[model samples]
Target: MSLEENATNRHGSPAHIQLPEQLSSKFIDRFIRLKTTYWNREYAIVLLAIIGVSITSQQFNTYIKYIDFMNQPNKTENFHLYGCLSYNLFGYMIGLIPGGVLATFYPAHNILGICVAISSIGHVIVIMSISYLNSLTLCILQMCIGTTMAVGDLSIDRVWTYWVPLNKQSIRHVPMVMYLVIFEEGYLRDTMDKLHNEHSSYSLTLFIGVIGLAWYVLWLYVINGNYSFGSLNRDFILFGGLNNSRYSFEAYGNSLTRSIVSDIPWKSIWTSKPFLAIVVLYVCDSRLYQSYYYNTDLFSNDVFEWTMRDNTVVLLLLVVVLVELFPEIALPISTTNVRKIWSCSYFGSLGIIFFLEVILGNTIKNNKMCQYLFKEMRHLYNFGFYVNTLDIAPKYASLLSSFLMCIHYYISDILWASVVRPILSFA
Candidate 1:
């Protein structure tokens, strides 16, 4: 007999039992959004996993920057540093195509899990290599790390394509971008008195690796993504004994989308105007972003002779990072509006870059203002073209994004070698 029936048979009625039961069910339904049929709770999990991977993957960069390798006990020449950087970039470029192809053929979450685990183990090996200061070993490990970085990047893109709903894309990306504001990159330097030893750094890397492995486990079991165990069906159990079987990538994909393998219109996609436009936009977008991120520190030091510890320099960096959050707050509800904002902001940034170089490049205060404006202008991209790859070609977004990245990096490397290097040397 049902609990209500038994209670009623024993007592006069089951009013007390039913009230608590109803309240518990209401609480659970509110917690899981069971009343809302459209929004899946797994989306939040995917975002968290992506954030975890992004933060953990930066260990190499963190170590390289904080170590001040050129002045260290194992002192190396600048040429070696340059070579390491070049090799790392090359590794990422070489892996892009293969990584995209692999993600396309397999389930994205599965590939993501494997890549994160590999990257985690790689962290240990990389730390060991650093102790020896063996250039060859370090270079090879950096290359491997770069390759995993590419694959991990593509996997996350594919997962986002498969998991996040269309209309919710802009708002969902906000958290990841906002994460940068709170995660102060200079915290390592600020806390150097505490984590002062190489061994401490090594231990931290290992701890992060463990966290990354936990992320892998979460993806392996919790997330029901594009393809689950060779089938295109969603079958997963959530907490509170609720079985969630209502969502799948196929159901969420574009209406005209067909079987993944047989339906890819590669020739059309390659030659189409929209795709070509997207490539042009992405190349320019990536170039601007890379230029700022990689060289902004150098620019400040060379032009203004300001160290990172300077009050002005620290404030500038804080302002630049804070500006990244503007788009997330200002983003509109519709994709069309988002696209308009992106176009305006992108062109406006290019104009600011030109104006800064030609007109206002003299004063330190002007430079700081210009840097803040430039960063603020670029982020409409987070809402627009960043997500539009999936919008245009849901099935082929990963492959296409990879191809665009390859092209952009090739162009960037060439420009850096021939144009940027010579100009900076002359200046």
Candidate 2:
């Protein structure tokens, strides 16, 4: 059957009909080809964003090392480290609502470009602050950097929805790809310690800054030259033609224009049992996860006397295993089932790991077997939770993501600052 006929039958025709000959065969061919292409224009955006996220992740994961670098002559206390980290989380909270609003109205690429540029500036500030031994300046810059990362992260869902057609099989893999990117950054930070020591912090900051600036320029070019808001304009040629109903495009475009709070079904969303459940799950998960993540080095040192390198190597291996293995195990199941299973399993495993660490504190010291097992379980759980987010509430994907992330960061930050840091200070 002709593409037009297939679309008409699938979406139902409008009152008016156009001839098949009027359809662009070339466009259709391009779209068909893009369906299979693993690294198309949409994927290019994903990749650039991944790089941006990885840079931020690397900074965060290596904050302890950064702190050591900053305290070249005088040794700072643990409170200083926790305080700097808390500021980043505070910035994450500050960014969410504004990021969501910006993403809803402006093009996602615009938000991304601005956020990336700001983050690059923050990196520069961080390097300078460290050199000058400006503690307050460093804290403020860290917060600003965190906010920029949050904005970029919150806006990413919009890019996926608009740029990648729903029909493509490759779309399903985007979440997994993102997970791998995040974990890879941690791995790189750990493994590249020698390289980082060889070079100055200025070199690292400059490298990340150059990448962000380059991505911003590329984003502007692609969004303006190739794509249009709310319609299949000139750039539809890249995706092959839009075969779906015009209403889909219209709705997407209209969504951007509507007021963020007024346009959304806030009452329905808040009342939604599934949505509420997911929010609760995320809050609990984030609290535990962030606490563990922020204090990973301390936890390893205190519990097992493992160095940062050891912790990072284990984390990297876990990420690799998850990236390679989980999809084969979980993708065959229903998306909802996969989400539930993964989340529950992850939480359970974390709980078990924590229990063991606490209960067998002295006996299991430097126990590589226990550490490896815990790492694998943690990665598996992460794989599941991320993929689940992509599948759940796709229509309200961006808004839902922003809401969940905002709450998650807020709760996690609170726990880290109020509960975790105080205890660490005393210890």
Candidate 3:
């Protein structure tokens, strides 16, 4: 028995693993040293931080506003705006499949920078199509906008994962959220709108061209494809053609790199129970995104009521002035229970919102209260998003969640592109 005990003990757990208390001053000191010494690779990180945030902030802010602007022909009917949003979202969702594949191959920084620049073309195209009376241009612009948005969104996650140490993804998302906050406040979008009004579509296009020029300069100067470029141990690389790639993730430290395209975690991800729950959670995010609206126009003049504008003004004020009027509640729960609550809350709210719309506020003039209530409610939606993000670790949280977005968007796109848009046209 003693001999058996000794043999079993010999195979016992290794002792090299440190206790929790051992993660003390020395552990922190090394991380600090790592950051301070410019030890992090990828010069593009700094530029990506600035430009990616800028593009996303402005793109989001102004992208939807165009639906309103497009409906400038009639001030009263903004339901067409929702149609436009659906158009954008549809395009975005459809394009993400190829977008993810492209990100796997492309030089991430360059692709991101180019995507940002080209997205402006999409905006300009909308203006030209409207002004010059050309549906062709509008279609082109819409398609491009969808494509660029997919590419840029993909690049942000891709590049972030590359440069940010696996440890810092959560902290990184906070700044990303800050940029989102900026867009929510309408800094860049409003600026673009003002520019659009002041200039012809061509002139606006030129203005965007200048912004693109600046972006390219910044991209080339600061952005790089890999972090601390030793050997590109990264998962993938761009090749000669539109849809070719070198390889993903190096095996061993061997100089001879190998293709890992097949090794993508798709099946495992889809099969895992936790992954499925997260997928359901993220699918709810898409719904929350849609429901965070002052309109239920499923097209035409039934979207983004006047109350949305008013509530936006109020939201900025309350958030800025009181600081603590609304508690920035951070829920620390990633378990199934939390996901269930959040999903139900959002879904329940959506149900109630629709119910109220039918009973109290169905028509534009009749449903002023419904419109107004939703304006307030939309801000509440942010908390739902917060709850969802809060429960998870930030590391690849943006990514893994975004992957779900990729899937949702893809399916939504197919439905929208094939069924929704054509039906709307007929209707």
lDDT of 1 by residue, 13-121 (tens): 5677678888888666654552242245556655755665575556556446434533467665643466567777778888898787656655666666677778777
Question: Looking at candidate 2, what is the lDDT of residue 193?
Answer: 76
Model 1 poorest 10 in a row by lDDT: 238-247
TM-scores, all models, native as reference: 0.64, 0.64, 0.53
Clash count list over all predictions: 0, 3, 13
Candidate 3 overall lDDT versus native: 0.51
lDDT of 2 by residue, 215-263 (tens): 5555655555456544435533232233233213244555544555456
Q: Write the per-residue lDDT of candidate 3 for residues 1-427, one digit (tens) a residue.
A: 3546655885654333434445566566655654553334453364354565466435544545555555677667754455556566667766665666545545455566667667765565554455564544455456567767776776665555555543421222333444444456455665687776876635554455456546654554444343333433332222111222332233233232122234355566567676666566556555555644435552223245333655565565444333222223222443345335645665676678666666777643455565455444544444444434323432233335456677575655565568867997999
Model 2 regions more than 4 Å off: 1-37, 56-70, 74-86, 125-142, 165-171, 174-185, 221-258, 290-332, 351-370, 412-427
CA lDDT of every candidate: 0.59, 0.61, 0.51
After the best TM-score superposition of candidate 3, give how far the Cα of residue 383 lies from its true spot, in angstroms: 6.3
Candidate 1: segments with Cα more than 4 A from true spot: 1-40, 62-71, 74-84, 128-134, 167-169, 179-199, 224-263, 288-334, 363-369, 415-427
Give the range of the ten consecutive residues with the poorest summed lDDT in model 3.
235-244
